[model samples]
Target: MLLREIQDEILRLKQEKDIAILAHSYQSHEITEVADFVGDSYALAKKAMTLTQKTVILCGVRFMAETVKILSPEKTVYLANSSAGCPMAEQFNKTDIENLRAKHPDYTVVAYINTTAELKTVCDVCVTSSCAEQVIRSMPQDKIIFVPDINLGTYCKNLVPEKDFILLDGGCPIHASMTENDVFKVKKQYPSAVFLAHPECKAEVTKQADYTGSTTGIMEYAIKSDKKEFIIGTENSIVEHLKYKCPDKKFFPLSNNFICGDMAITSVFDILDCINGKGEEIKIDEDTRIAAKKCIDKMIEYGG
Candidate 1:
């Protein structure tokens, strides 16, 4: 079937079957085109929970799909592409966190949302890229151990100077690879454009940005502001999303090399196949689900 035909079928099936399709900002242009909602991971998951749909198709990475399952366990959640897994999310498992907890008994383990459901089970609280600093700072504890993203942990440390934090050697390789030089080059080319970056990026890149936020936050900021041009510092797919959402504005990529293969792997065909029940459905054990839900729920309560 052609791309348009598949998209038409998705629209028809969603209405006929009470389904909702959620795409991440990093999804392909075609996938985002047909999605009911497209935003950051936490926002998508939270939106999925409030949705009245019977089934949800998450067109993102494994952990994002798992987050939908975590929030709306009653609603059937399907991953558009099972192989689309985040390397940062897979960095720390339950065993690793359990060992870390044992080693640092005095510290509270805070996990980034880009983590497996099992890892969340071992975490004291969960945080997204947007709320990590706020949530971590609000905690009463003096010592904290942040996992699965060293860049983000370092960013948090910079924000809360008084607190002691142990940063794990894990991060999004794609974002970490970006440097201040990329921001400078983009600024030189697009002097009029505002630079917006993701906090997962290295401190140097983030420090140079005109504004730093999560994928969804960046979209909202660009859309709401009168700025006609912006240099987006996340995945390349975001430029596609912004172009669609705000046609009047010009969105430039920070660097041609800044891309998340994992997030970009899922295509519109994968989403259509998932909605048609040919793709894989994410399933987690009840124990893992319940335990993970605790951490996620705490995030909703405190982090929100």
Candidate 2:
């Protein structure tokens, strides 16, 4: 009946049932502890596709579970918490992308991986925060329509100043809300600590960072870097994970307000309930799966 006992049971059940648990970096530490793999959204989905598990419990949001289903249509994908949804993912829809495409016939649409499957259906290619810069720079098109996250699009554009990017008016409200003052305060508090930021943050916030990257990239940098302290400019959950990963190093969050309530809503209990057959399972239509796969496959082919 205890939490430890439940976790043990969940792990045992996962092995007995051939289920792979995939946790996003923004998930709680307890959830990550029980997961088979924990990383960024796209990386977690890609890893799920390669696993031989018949079922995958995605401890993230609705769109993330849908992404796993899109990648591995044969496997059963379940979202740990059905209520957990990304606001940014919900900001754009199929009609929105179609409308944009109609207006700009000559531009190639590059969607951020944090999107609904329906949105992916209309995209020319998909990109993750970590690979967006590289993928966009490698594309043949001179004019790019980066969607659903203007902050990330701007970050990519800054990396490739020669290319013209049409950024959509959508972004993570949590990260977008972060101001230059937050960056200044963090810097002042930890003068020696290196500042690592996520591309989802505003341009001004990212400009003050020592390094800008995805959530996974931030974690990797902190682990590999020689620095003893770091100021993380992303979701607060990441700071929690970093503390456990590197107990010797000091990690400070850019702002306490930079929290994704949706991402944080899912916990180990929800994941266990799903594995026990009491949670909602993510089901995608064959057409949507096929359509969504096109953009994701293109992303893997080009971004890989």
| 102-172 per-residue lDDT for model 1 (tens digits) | 99999998899999998999998899988987887777887999998998899899999999999999999
How accurate locally, in lDDT, is each candidate? 0.88, 0.90
lDDT by residue for model 2 over 1-304, one digit each (tens)?
7878878988998999888999998988888889999988888888987998888999999989999899888888899999999999989888888998899999999999999998899998999998888788777888999998999999999899999889999999999999999888888888999999999999999999899999988999999998999999999999999999899999999988878999989877887898888889888899988998999888777864
Candidates in order, TM-scores: namely 0.96, 0.97
Clashing residue pairs in all predictions, respectively, total: 0, 0
Candidate 2: residue pairs that collide: none
Q: What stretches of model 2 exceed 4 Å from their correct place?
A: none
Name the lDDT value of residue 159 in candidate 1.
Answer: 90
Query: Model 1: which ten-residue window has the lowest total lDDT?
Result: 295-304
Model 2 TM: 0.97
